[model samples]
Target: MAPSKGRGGRRRPARPHAHYARHGPQPGLSRLHRAPPPDDAERLHHVGPPVPHPTAHRDPADLCRGQLGAEWHPDFHPREDELVMRQHWSSSGFANTDLDFMLKQHHIRKILLIGMRANTCVDTTARFGQELGYHVTLIRDAIASFSWEEMTATFELNAPLYAHAILTTDEFVDIVNDGAGKGSP
Candidate 1:
Protein backbone atom coordinates (compact mmCIF):
# COMPACT_ATOMS: atom_id res chain seq x y z
CA MET A 1 0.00 0.00 0.00
CA ALA A 2 1.01 3.66 -0.41
CA PRO A 3 2.08 5.96 2.38
CA SER A 4 0.24 8.38 4.59
CA LYS A 5 0.88 11.73 6.27
CA GLY A 6 3.21 11.52 9.25
CA ARG A 7 3.64 13.96 12.12
CA GLY A 8 5.31 16.62 10.01
CA GLY A 9 2.71 16.07 7.33
CA ARG A 10 5.19 14.07 5.26
CA ARG A 11 4.17 10.68 3.90
CA ARG A 12 6.35 7.66 4.55
CA PRO A 13 6.54 4.92 2.00
CA ALA A 14 4.30 1.83 2.49
CA ARG A 15 2.23 2.83 5.43
CA PRO A 16 -0.07 -0.05 6.41
CA HIS A 17 -3.34 0.99 8.03
CA ALA A 18 -2.60 4.58 7.25
CA HIS A 19 -2.65 4.06 3.54
CA TYR A 20 -3.99 7.23 2.04
CA ALA A 21 -6.80 7.23 -0.45
CA ARG A 22 -5.31 9.05 -3.43
CA HIS A 23 -8.51 9.58 -5.34
CA GLY A 24 -10.93 12.27 -6.51
CA PRO A 25 -11.56 14.45 -9.54
CA GLN A 26 -8.33 16.11 -10.64
CA PRO A 27 -7.42 19.77 -10.56
CA GLY A 28 -9.81 21.96 -12.47
CA LEU A 29 -11.12 18.35 -12.58
CA SER A 30 -12.90 19.15 -15.77
CA ARG A 31 -9.39 18.88 -17.25
CA LEU A 32 -6.97 17.24 -14.81
CA HIS A 33 -9.05 14.65 -12.94
CA ARG A 34 -6.93 11.52 -12.60
CA ALA A 35 -4.73 9.64 -10.05
CA PRO A 36 -6.12 11.03 -6.87
CA PRO A 37 -7.72 14.05 -8.39
CA PRO A 38 -7.81 17.39 -6.63
CA ASP A 39 -9.73 17.74 -3.41
CA ASP A 40 -13.29 19.01 -3.45
CA ALA A 41 -12.07 22.47 -2.44
CA GLU A 42 -9.48 22.45 -5.21
CA ARG A 43 -11.56 20.63 -7.81
CA LEU A 44 -14.12 22.17 -10.12
CA HIS A 45 -17.50 22.53 -8.50
CA HIS A 46 -19.51 23.59 -11.52
CA VAL A 47 -22.35 21.38 -12.74
CA GLY A 48 -20.81 21.16 -16.16
CA PRO A 49 -19.32 23.08 -19.07
CA PRO A 50 -22.78 22.95 -20.62
CA VAL A 51 -23.29 20.50 -23.47
CA PRO A 52 -25.90 20.39 -26.19
CA HIS A 53 -28.76 17.91 -26.24
CA PRO A 54 -28.01 14.29 -27.00
CA THR A 55 -27.95 13.98 -30.77
CA ALA A 56 -26.56 10.49 -30.82
CA HIS A 57 -28.66 8.66 -28.19
CA ARG A 58 -32.14 9.16 -26.93
CA ASP A 59 -30.92 9.09 -23.35
CA PRO A 60 -29.13 12.35 -22.63
CA ALA A 61 -28.09 11.00 -19.24
CA ASP A 62 -25.66 8.62 -20.91
CA LEU A 63 -23.74 11.60 -22.26
CA CYS A 64 -24.43 14.26 -19.65
CA ARG A 65 -24.59 14.61 -15.89
CA GLY A 66 -27.57 15.70 -13.70
CA GLN A 67 -29.80 13.61 -15.98
CA LEU A 68 -30.65 10.25 -14.45
CA GLY A 69 -33.29 7.63 -15.23
CA ALA A 70 -33.79 4.28 -16.94
CA GLU A 71 -33.87 5.99 -20.32
CA TRP A 72 -30.16 6.83 -20.05
CA HIS A 73 -29.28 3.15 -20.08
CA PRO A 74 -28.87 1.00 -23.14
CA ASP A 75 -31.22 -1.70 -24.45
CA PHE A 76 -28.97 -4.53 -23.25
CA HIS A 77 -29.55 -3.31 -19.71
CA PRO A 78 -32.26 -4.40 -17.19
CA ARG A 79 -31.16 -7.93 -17.82
CA GLU A 80 -30.31 -10.52 -15.20
CA ASP A 81 -27.01 -10.16 -13.26
CA GLU A 82 -26.34 -6.84 -14.99
CA LEU A 83 -25.36 -3.70 -13.13
CA VAL A 84 -26.29 -0.27 -14.36
CA MET A 85 -24.26 2.51 -12.82
CA ARG A 86 -25.11 6.15 -12.98
CA GLN A 87 -23.25 8.41 -15.36
CA HIS A 88 -19.57 8.41 -14.51
CA TRP A 89 -18.85 11.54 -12.53
CA SER A 90 -15.09 11.08 -12.87
CA SER A 91 -12.57 9.30 -15.04
CA SER A 92 -11.51 6.91 -12.25
CA GLY A 93 -14.36 4.46 -11.57
CA PHE A 94 -13.18 4.01 -7.99
CA ALA A 95 -13.11 7.72 -7.24
CA ASN A 96 -16.84 8.20 -6.82
CA THR A 97 -18.35 4.89 -7.95
CA ASP A 98 -17.89 2.81 -4.77
CA LEU A 99 -16.25 0.07 -6.84
CA ASP A 100 -13.31 -0.32 -4.49
CA PHE A 101 -15.52 -0.55 -1.47
CA MET A 102 -17.69 -3.12 -3.14
CA LEU A 103 -14.70 -5.17 -4.29
CA LYS A 104 -13.12 -5.20 -0.86
CA GLN A 105 -16.40 -6.17 0.65
CA HIS A 106 -16.45 -9.23 -1.55
CA HIS A 107 -12.74 -9.86 -0.86
CA ILE A 108 -11.93 -9.40 -4.54
CA ARG A 109 -8.42 -8.16 -5.13
CA LYS A 110 -7.92 -8.85 -8.80
CA ILE A 111 -9.71 -6.83 -11.46
CA LEU A 112 -10.20 -7.40 -15.16
CA LEU A 113 -11.00 -4.20 -16.99
CA ILE A 114 -12.58 -4.26 -20.45
CA GLY A 115 -14.28 -1.30 -22.04
CA MET A 116 -13.98 1.54 -24.52
CA ARG A 117 -11.40 4.32 -24.27
CA ALA A 118 -8.33 2.20 -23.71
CA ASN A 119 -6.05 5.08 -22.86
CA THR A 120 -8.21 7.53 -20.95
CA CYS A 121 -10.94 6.18 -18.69
CA VAL A 122 -9.75 2.57 -18.68
CA ASP A 123 -6.17 3.49 -17.92
CA THR A 124 -7.21 5.95 -15.24
CA THR A 125 -9.43 3.38 -13.55
CA ALA A 126 -6.73 0.70 -13.70
CA ARG A 127 -4.04 2.95 -12.33
CA PHE A 128 -6.26 4.18 -9.55
CA GLY A 129 -7.11 0.62 -8.57
CA GLN A 130 -3.48 -0.47 -8.69
CA GLU A 131 -2.49 2.41 -6.45
CA LEU A 132 -5.16 1.38 -4.02
CA GLY A 133 -3.61 -2.11 -3.73
CA TYR A 134 -5.62 -4.13 -6.25
CA HIS A 135 -4.18 -6.50 -8.79
CA VAL A 136 -5.34 -4.96 -12.08
CA THR A 137 -5.43 -6.78 -15.39
CA LEU A 138 -6.17 -5.32 -18.80
CA ILE A 139 -7.45 -7.38 -21.68
CA ARG A 140 -5.68 -6.16 -24.80
CA ASP A 141 -8.22 -6.83 -27.53
CA ALA A 142 -11.24 -6.37 -25.29
CA ILE A 143 -10.54 -2.65 -25.07
CA ALA A 144 -10.60 -0.09 -27.85
CA SER A 145 -9.56 3.46 -28.59
CA PHE A 146 -10.31 6.04 -31.22
CA SER A 147 -7.08 5.10 -32.98
CA TRP A 148 -4.63 2.23 -33.12
CA GLU A 149 -1.95 4.42 -31.61
CA GLU A 150 -3.97 5.12 -28.49
CA MET A 151 -4.66 1.45 -27.94
CA THR A 152 -1.02 0.61 -28.53
CA ALA A 153 0.18 3.27 -26.14
CA THR A 154 -2.09 2.13 -23.36
CA PHE A 155 -1.41 -1.62 -23.53
CA GLU A 156 2.20 -1.24 -24.62
CA LEU A 157 3.43 1.57 -22.39
CA ASN A 158 1.05 2.77 -19.73
CA ALA A 159 -0.54 -0.58 -18.87
CA PRO A 160 2.81 -2.19 -18.12
CA LEU A 161 3.45 0.47 -15.52
CA TYR A 162 0.42 -0.58 -13.49
CA ALA A 163 -1.41 -3.66 -14.72
CA HIS A 164 -0.38 -6.97 -13.18
CA ALA A 165 -1.13 -8.92 -16.33
CA ILE A 166 -2.07 -7.97 -19.87
CA LEU A 167 -3.97 -10.77 -21.52
CA THR A 168 -6.00 -11.27 -24.65
CA THR A 169 -9.65 -12.28 -24.75
CA ASP A 170 -8.68 -15.80 -25.76
CA GLU A 171 -6.17 -16.06 -22.93
CA PHE A 172 -8.80 -14.91 -20.46
CA VAL A 173 -11.21 -17.52 -21.74
CA ASP A 174 -8.56 -20.18 -21.49
CA ILE A 175 -7.94 -19.27 -17.91
CA VAL A 176 -11.62 -19.57 -17.18
CA ASN A 177 -12.07 -22.79 -19.07
CA ASP A 178 -8.89 -24.27 -17.63
CA GLY A 179 -10.36 -23.88 -14.15
CA ALA A 180 -7.74 -21.34 -13.16
CA GLY A 181 -10.39 -18.67 -12.82
CA LYS A 182 -13.22 -20.78 -11.48
CA GLY A 183 -13.92 -19.13 -8.15
CA SER A 184 -13.34 -15.49 -8.98
CA PRO A 185 -14.04 -12.67 -11.46
Candidate 2:
Protein backbone atom coordinates (compact mmCIF):
# COMPACT_ATOMS: atom_id res chain seq x y z
CA MET A 1 0.00 0.00 0.00
CA ALA A 2 2.63 2.45 -1.08
CA PRO A 3 1.90 5.93 -2.39
CA SER A 4 -1.51 4.90 -3.58
CA LYS A 5 -4.37 7.33 -3.68
CA GLY A 6 -6.78 5.46 -1.49
CA ARG A 7 -10.39 6.08 -0.68
CA GLY A 8 -11.46 9.66 0.08
CA GLY A 9 -8.56 10.86 -2.07
CA ARG A 10 -6.10 10.22 0.73
CA ARG A 11 -2.59 9.14 -0.15
CA ARG A 12 -0.75 6.24 1.43
CA PRO A 13 2.95 6.26 2.19
CA ALA A 14 5.38 5.04 -0.45
CA ARG A 15 7.04 2.90 2.17
CA PRO A 16 5.42 0.59 4.72
CA HIS A 17 7.48 1.79 7.64
CA ALA A 18 5.20 3.41 10.21
CA HIS A 19 5.47 4.69 13.77
CA TYR A 20 4.95 1.96 16.32
CA ALA A 21 1.59 2.20 18.06
CA ARG A 22 0.05 -0.19 20.55
CA HIS A 23 3.15 -2.33 20.23
CA GLY A 24 3.43 -2.88 23.97
CA PRO A 25 4.14 -1.16 27.24
CA GLN A 26 0.84 -2.91 27.48
CA PRO A 27 -1.62 -1.54 30.04
CA GLY A 28 -2.58 -5.03 31.07
CA LEU A 29 0.35 -4.89 33.44
CA SER A 30 -1.10 -1.81 35.15
CA ARG A 31 1.98 0.33 34.66
CA LEU A 32 2.02 4.15 34.27
CA HIS A 33 2.69 6.66 31.51
CA ARG A 34 6.24 7.61 30.63
CA ALA A 35 6.18 11.23 31.89
CA PRO A 36 4.43 13.64 34.30
CA PRO A 37 4.11 10.90 36.85
CA PRO A 38 1.05 8.70 37.44
CA ASP A 39 -1.22 11.30 39.08
CA ASP A 40 -1.81 13.57 36.07
CA ALA A 41 -0.92 11.31 33.18
CA GLU A 42 -2.90 12.89 30.38
CA ARG A 43 -0.74 14.27 27.67
CA LEU A 44 0.49 13.23 24.24
CA HIS A 45 3.66 14.63 22.64
CA HIS A 46 3.77 15.56 18.96
CA VAL A 47 0.03 14.92 18.91
CA GLY A 48 -0.99 18.40 17.74
CA PRO A 49 -2.71 21.20 19.64
CA PRO A 50 -5.17 20.32 22.42
CA VAL A 51 -4.81 16.64 23.26
CA PRO A 52 -8.08 14.86 22.64
CA HIS A 53 -10.04 13.69 25.69
CA PRO A 54 -8.69 16.04 28.27
CA THR A 55 -10.59 14.42 31.12
CA ALA A 56 -9.24 10.99 30.40
CA HIS A 57 -9.01 8.00 32.69
CA ARG A 58 -5.91 7.67 34.82
CA ASP A 59 -3.59 5.27 33.07
CA PRO A 60 -0.10 6.18 31.96
CA ALA A 61 1.71 4.02 29.41
CA ASP A 62 5.13 3.92 31.08
CA LEU A 63 6.92 4.17 34.43
CA CYS A 64 10.52 4.53 33.50
CA ARG A 65 12.65 1.45 34.38
CA GLY A 66 10.47 0.30 37.24
CA GLN A 67 9.55 -3.35 37.64
CA LEU A 68 6.05 -2.51 36.46
CA GLY A 69 6.96 0.39 34.21
CA ALA A 70 4.80 0.90 31.17
CA GLU A 71 7.59 0.22 28.74
CA TRP A 72 8.12 -2.07 25.83
CA HIS A 73 10.48 -4.98 26.11
CA PRO A 74 14.09 -4.08 25.46
CA ASP A 75 13.87 -6.12 22.28
CA PHE A 76 11.21 -3.72 20.99
CA HIS A 77 13.00 -0.43 21.60
CA PRO A 78 12.35 2.27 19.09
CA ARG A 79 14.81 2.59 16.22
CA GLU A 80 16.46 5.87 15.32
CA ASP A 81 14.03 8.54 14.11
CA GLU A 82 11.17 6.29 15.09
CA LEU A 83 8.32 7.31 17.37
CA VAL A 84 6.44 4.99 19.68
CA MET A 85 3.12 6.46 20.69
CA ARG A 86 1.69 5.15 23.90
CA GLN A 87 -2.00 4.56 23.73
CA HIS A 88 -3.96 5.77 26.76
CA TRP A 89 -6.88 3.57 25.97
CA SER A 90 -7.00 -0.18 25.90
CA SER A 91 -8.46 -0.68 22.45
CA SER A 92 -7.62 2.14 20.07
CA GLY A 93 -4.16 3.48 19.35
CA PHE A 94 -5.71 6.73 18.13
CA ALA A 95 -7.02 7.48 21.59
CA ASN A 96 -3.85 8.96 23.02
CA THR A 97 -1.13 8.67 20.42
CA ASP A 98 0.26 10.54 17.45
CA LEU A 99 -0.79 7.83 15.03
CA ASP A 100 -3.07 10.18 13.20
CA PHE A 101 -0.34 12.76 12.87
CA MET A 102 2.22 10.25 11.66
CA LEU A 103 -0.22 8.88 9.14
CA LYS A 104 -1.04 12.30 7.84
CA GLN A 105 2.55 13.55 7.87
CA HIS A 106 3.60 10.60 5.77
CA HIS A 107 0.48 10.79 3.58
CA ILE A 108 -0.71 7.41 4.75
CA ARG A 109 -4.26 6.53 4.00
CA LYS A 110 -4.08 2.81 3.52
CA ILE A 111 -3.44 1.12 6.86
CA LEU A 112 -1.78 -2.27 7.11
CA LEU A 113 -2.40 -3.72 10.58
CA ILE A 114 -0.61 -6.51 12.44
CA GLY A 115 0.16 -7.38 16.06
CA MET A 116 -0.87 -9.57 18.97
CA ARG A 117 -4.11 -7.88 20.01
CA ALA A 118 -6.21 -8.88 17.05
CA ASN A 119 -9.52 -8.79 18.88
CA THR A 120 -8.75 -5.71 20.92
CA CYS A 121 -6.15 -3.17 19.86
CA VAL A 122 -5.84 -4.29 16.24
CA ASP A 123 -9.58 -4.55 15.83
CA THR A 124 -10.30 -1.17 17.36
CA THR A 125 -7.51 0.61 15.47
CA ALA A 126 -8.60 -0.89 12.16
CA ARG A 127 -12.24 -0.01 12.69
CA PHE A 128 -11.44 3.54 13.70
CA GLY A 129 -9.05 4.03 10.80
CA GLN A 130 -11.70 2.82 8.40
CA GLU A 131 -14.17 5.22 9.94
CA LEU A 132 -11.68 8.02 9.37
CA GLY A 133 -11.58 6.94 5.70
CA TYR A 134 -8.27 5.11 5.69
CA HIS A 135 -8.17 1.96 3.60
CA VAL A 136 -7.41 -0.70 6.19
CA THR A 137 -5.69 -3.99 5.48
CA LEU A 138 -5.27 -6.76 7.98
CA ILE A 139 -2.32 -9.17 7.84
CA ARG A 140 -3.99 -12.32 9.06
CA ASP A 141 -0.93 -14.38 9.79
CA ALA A 142 0.72 -11.46 11.50
CA ILE A 143 -2.05 -10.93 14.04
CA ALA A 144 -3.12 -13.00 16.98
CA SER A 145 -5.45 -12.91 19.97
CA PHE A 146 -5.72 -14.32 23.44
CA SER A 147 -7.79 -17.17 22.10
CA TRP A 148 -8.18 -18.98 18.81
CA GLU A 149 -11.86 -18.08 18.64
CA GLU A 150 -11.00 -14.45 19.08
CA MET A 151 -8.54 -14.65 16.22
CA THR A 152 -11.09 -16.32 14.01
CA ALA A 153 -13.72 -13.77 14.90
CA THR A 154 -11.38 -10.91 14.17
CA PHE A 155 -10.05 -12.06 10.79
CA GLU A 156 -12.93 -14.17 9.51
CA LEU A 157 -16.14 -12.70 10.82
CA ASN A 158 -15.66 -9.14 11.99
CA ALA A 159 -12.78 -8.01 9.81
CA PRO A 160 -14.75 -8.28 6.58
CA LEU A 161 -16.89 -5.45 7.86
CA TYR A 162 -14.13 -2.87 8.19
CA ALA A 163 -10.94 -4.19 6.63
CA HIS A 164 -10.52 -3.22 3.00
CA ALA A 165 -8.14 -6.10 2.34
CA ILE A 166 -7.16 -9.15 4.33
CA LEU A 167 -4.09 -11.17 3.50
CA THR A 168 -1.62 -13.49 5.09
CA THR A 169 1.84 -12.08 5.66
CA ASP A 170 3.22 -14.23 2.88
CA GLU A 171 0.54 -13.12 0.43
CA PHE A 172 1.15 -9.51 1.31
CA VAL A 173 4.89 -9.97 0.96
CA ASP A 174 4.31 -11.55 -2.42
CA ILE A 175 2.28 -8.57 -3.50
CA VAL A 176 4.84 -6.14 -2.20
CA ASN A 177 7.97 -7.97 -3.29
CA ASP A 178 6.92 -9.83 -6.39
CA GLY A 179 3.84 -8.47 -8.15
CA ALA A 180 0.59 -9.29 -6.44
CA GLY A 181 0.26 -5.53 -6.75
CA LYS A 182 3.29 -3.37 -7.46
CA GLY A 183 4.72 -0.28 -5.67
CA SER A 184 5.39 -2.10 -2.40
CA PRO A 185 8.57 -3.74 -1.14
Candidate 3:
Protein backbone atom coordinates (compact mmCIF):
# COMPACT_ATOMS: atom_id res chain seq x y z
CA MET A 1 0.00 0.00 0.00
CA ALA A 2 1.32 3.41 -0.97
CA PRO A 3 0.50 6.78 0.53
CA SER A 4 -2.52 8.59 -0.92
CA LYS A 5 -2.41 11.90 -2.71
CA GLY A 6 -5.45 12.79 -0.57
CA ARG A 7 -7.03 15.39 -2.79
CA GLY A 8 -9.01 17.51 -0.34
CA GLY A 9 -12.27 16.13 1.13
CA ARG A 10 -14.79 13.49 0.11
CA ARG A 11 -14.58 12.63 -3.58
CA ARG A 12 -17.45 13.38 -5.91
CA PRO A 13 -19.20 10.29 -7.27
CA ALA A 14 -18.47 11.29 -10.85
CA ARG A 15 -14.75 11.47 -10.05
CA PRO A 16 -14.19 8.08 -8.50
CA HIS A 17 -11.24 7.35 -10.76
CA ALA A 18 -9.58 10.58 -9.76
CA HIS A 19 -10.12 9.69 -6.14
CA TYR A 20 -8.04 6.53 -6.58
CA ALA A 21 -5.23 8.24 -8.47
CA ARG A 22 -4.94 10.78 -5.67
CA HIS A 23 -4.09 7.92 -3.35
CA GLY A 24 -0.70 7.22 -4.87
CA PRO A 25 -0.13 3.88 -6.63
CA GLN A 26 -1.14 0.34 -5.72
CA PRO A 27 1.52 -1.97 -7.23
CA GLY A 28 -0.18 -4.37 -9.72
CA LEU A 29 -3.39 -2.39 -9.94
CA SER A 30 -4.34 -0.76 -13.27
CA ARG A 31 -5.28 2.88 -13.27
CA LEU A 32 -8.05 4.22 -15.55
CA HIS A 33 -7.25 7.94 -15.48
CA ARG A 34 -3.82 7.77 -17.11
CA ALA A 35 -3.22 7.04 -20.76
CA PRO A 36 -1.85 3.61 -21.65
CA PRO A 37 1.92 3.54 -21.88
CA PRO A 38 2.95 2.97 -25.51
CA ASP A 39 5.54 0.27 -24.77
CA ASP A 40 3.12 -2.07 -23.00
CA ALA A 41 3.12 -5.25 -25.12
CA GLU A 42 2.21 -7.88 -22.58
CA ARG A 43 -1.17 -8.57 -24.15
CA LEU A 44 -2.42 -6.01 -21.67
CA HIS A 45 -5.79 -6.95 -20.24
CA HIS A 46 -8.10 -4.57 -18.38
CA VAL A 47 -10.35 -6.48 -16.00
CA GLY A 48 -13.45 -4.71 -14.84
CA PRO A 49 -17.24 -4.71 -15.36
CA PRO A 50 -17.68 -2.46 -18.43
CA VAL A 51 -18.24 1.16 -19.26
CA PRO A 52 -20.12 3.17 -16.63
CA HIS A 53 -22.43 6.21 -17.12
CA PRO A 54 -19.65 8.73 -16.56
CA THR A 55 -17.57 7.06 -19.30
CA ALA A 56 -20.37 7.56 -21.85
CA HIS A 57 -19.25 11.17 -21.93
CA ARG A 58 -15.93 9.87 -23.25
CA ASP A 59 -15.20 8.13 -26.55
CA PRO A 60 -15.64 4.44 -27.43
CA ALA A 61 -12.13 4.07 -28.87
CA ASP A 62 -10.80 4.50 -25.35
CA LEU A 63 -12.93 1.56 -24.24
CA CYS A 64 -11.09 -0.82 -26.54
CA ARG A 65 -7.87 0.36 -24.88
CA GLY A 66 -9.25 -0.47 -21.45
CA GLN A 67 -12.57 1.38 -21.26
CA LEU A 68 -11.86 5.11 -21.38
CA GLY A 69 -8.46 4.14 -19.94
CA ALA A 70 -10.48 2.70 -17.03
CA GLU A 71 -12.68 -0.26 -16.11
CA TRP A 72 -16.47 -0.14 -15.82
CA HIS A 73 -19.10 -2.34 -14.25
CA PRO A 74 -21.47 -4.53 -16.32
CA ASP A 75 -24.58 -3.15 -14.64
CA PHE A 76 -23.13 0.32 -14.47
CA HIS A 77 -25.97 2.67 -15.35
CA PRO A 78 -26.13 3.84 -18.98
CA ARG A 79 -24.04 0.98 -20.36
CA GLU A 80 -21.40 1.50 -22.99
CA ASP A 81 -19.26 -1.34 -24.48
CA GLU A 82 -18.57 -4.10 -21.97
CA LEU A 83 -15.23 -5.95 -21.63
CA VAL A 84 -16.29 -9.45 -22.65
CA MET A 85 -13.64 -11.23 -20.55
CA ARG A 86 -13.83 -9.44 -17.23
CA GLN A 87 -14.60 -12.07 -14.63
CA HIS A 88 -16.41 -12.05 -11.30
CA TRP A 89 -14.47 -14.03 -8.66
CA SER A 90 -15.74 -16.20 -5.85
CA SER A 91 -12.77 -16.90 -3.51
CA SER A 92 -10.82 -19.16 -5.92
CA GLY A 93 -10.49 -16.52 -8.69
CA PHE A 94 -12.25 -18.48 -11.45
CA ALA A 95 -14.92 -16.36 -13.10
CA ASN A 96 -17.37 -17.02 -15.91
CA THR A 97 -15.09 -14.85 -18.09
CA ASP A 98 -12.51 -17.63 -18.42
CA LEU A 99 -9.55 -15.40 -17.62
CA ASP A 100 -7.71 -18.47 -16.37
CA PHE A 101 -8.35 -20.28 -19.61
CA MET A 102 -7.14 -17.28 -21.56
CA LEU A 103 -3.92 -17.20 -19.59
CA LYS A 104 -3.36 -20.89 -20.03
CA GLN A 105 -4.06 -20.70 -23.72
CA HIS A 106 -1.49 -17.96 -24.04
CA HIS A 107 1.05 -20.00 -22.02
CA ILE A 108 1.19 -17.02 -19.69
CA ARG A 109 2.95 -18.29 -16.60
CA LYS A 110 3.71 -14.72 -15.55
CA ILE A 111 1.01 -12.04 -15.52
CA LEU A 112 1.37 -8.26 -15.52
CA LEU A 113 -1.97 -7.11 -14.09
CA ILE A 114 -3.68 -3.74 -14.22
CA GLY A 115 -7.31 -2.72 -13.83
CA MET A 116 -9.93 -0.81 -11.84
CA ARG A 117 -10.92 -1.17 -8.17
CA ALA A 118 -7.66 -2.20 -6.53
CA ASN A 119 -9.33 -4.15 -3.76
CA THR A 120 -11.79 -5.96 -5.98
CA CYS A 121 -10.77 -7.38 -9.36
CA VAL A 122 -7.10 -6.52 -9.00
CA ASP A 123 -6.82 -8.07 -5.57
CA THR A 124 -9.14 -10.92 -6.46
CA THR A 125 -7.13 -11.76 -9.55
CA ALA A 126 -3.88 -11.71 -7.60
CA ARG A 127 -5.45 -14.03 -5.07
CA PHE A 128 -6.71 -16.16 -7.93
CA GLY A 129 -3.17 -16.49 -9.24
CA GLN A 130 -2.12 -17.76 -5.85
CA GLU A 131 -4.94 -20.28 -5.95
CA LEU A 132 -4.11 -21.42 -9.49
CA GLY A 133 -0.42 -21.44 -8.60
CA TYR A 134 0.71 -18.88 -11.13
CA HIS A 135 3.19 -16.06 -10.75
CA VAL A 136 1.26 -12.76 -10.54
CA THR A 137 3.02 -9.41 -10.51
CA LEU A 138 0.91 -6.39 -9.58
CA ILE A 139 2.23 -3.25 -11.21
CA ARG A 140 1.31 -0.59 -8.68
CA ASP A 141 1.76 2.45 -10.88
CA ALA A 142 -0.36 0.84 -13.56
CA ILE A 143 -3.19 0.30 -11.09
CA ALA A 144 -5.63 2.64 -9.30
CA SER A 145 -8.63 2.60 -6.98
CA PHE A 146 -11.82 4.50 -6.07
CA SER A 147 -11.93 3.61 -2.40
CA TRP A 148 -9.24 5.61 -0.66
CA GLU A 149 -9.41 4.10 2.85
CA GLU A 150 -10.09 0.52 1.87
CA MET A 151 -7.40 0.59 -0.81
CA THR A 152 -4.77 1.83 1.58
CA ALA A 153 -5.87 -0.46 4.36
CA THR A 154 -5.87 -3.58 2.23
CA PHE A 155 -2.40 -2.97 0.85
CA GLU A 156 -1.18 -2.09 4.30
CA LEU A 157 -2.16 -5.49 5.64
CA ASN A 158 -3.25 -7.90 2.94
CA ALA A 159 -0.88 -7.35 0.00
CA PRO A 160 2.19 -8.46 1.96
CA LEU A 161 0.38 -11.61 2.94
CA TYR A 162 -0.87 -12.52 -0.55
CA ALA A 163 1.18 -11.04 -3.42
CA HIS A 164 4.33 -9.42 -4.68
CA ALA A 165 3.32 -5.80 -5.33
CA ILE A 166 5.83 -3.78 -7.32
CA LEU A 167 5.75 0.00 -6.87
CA THR A 168 6.17 1.27 -10.44
CA THR A 169 5.11 0.39 -13.98
CA ASP A 170 8.69 0.24 -15.15
CA GLU A 171 9.64 -2.18 -12.40
CA PHE A 172 6.68 -4.35 -13.32
CA VAL A 173 7.61 -4.52 -16.99
CA ASP A 174 11.27 -5.11 -16.19
CA ILE A 175 10.42 -7.99 -13.89
CA VAL A 176 8.39 -9.72 -16.57
CA ASN A 177 11.06 -9.05 -19.16
CA ASP A 178 13.59 -10.51 -16.74
CA GLY A 179 11.60 -13.74 -16.57
CA ALA A 180 10.22 -13.18 -13.11
CA GLY A 181 8.78 -16.29 -11.55
CA LYS A 182 5.81 -16.51 -9.18
CA GLY A 183 5.48 -18.90 -6.28
CA SER A 184 3.72 -19.34 -2.94
CA PRO A 185 3.68 -16.23 -0.84
How well is each residue in 120-158 modelled by candidate 3, as lDDT tens digits? 666776787867867666555455676555466445555
Q: Candidate 2 overall Cα lDDT vs. reference?
A: 0.52
The lDDT leader among the candidates is 2
Candidate 1 residue spans exceeding 4 A from truth: 1-83, 180-185
As a whole number from 0 to 100, the lDDT of residue 96 in candidate 1 is: 50
| lDDT tens digits, residue span 52-106, model 1 | 2232356655665544422322311233433334434446666556566656655
In model 2, which regions exceed 4 Å deviation? 1-76, 180-185
TM-score for all models, in order of appearance: 0.57, 0.59, 0.50
Assess the local accuracy of residue 124 in candidate 3 as a C-alpha lDDT between 0 and 100.
74
- For candidate 3, the clash count comes to 12
Question: Which of 2 and 3 is the better model by TM-score?
Answer: 2
* TM-score winner, 1 or 2: 2
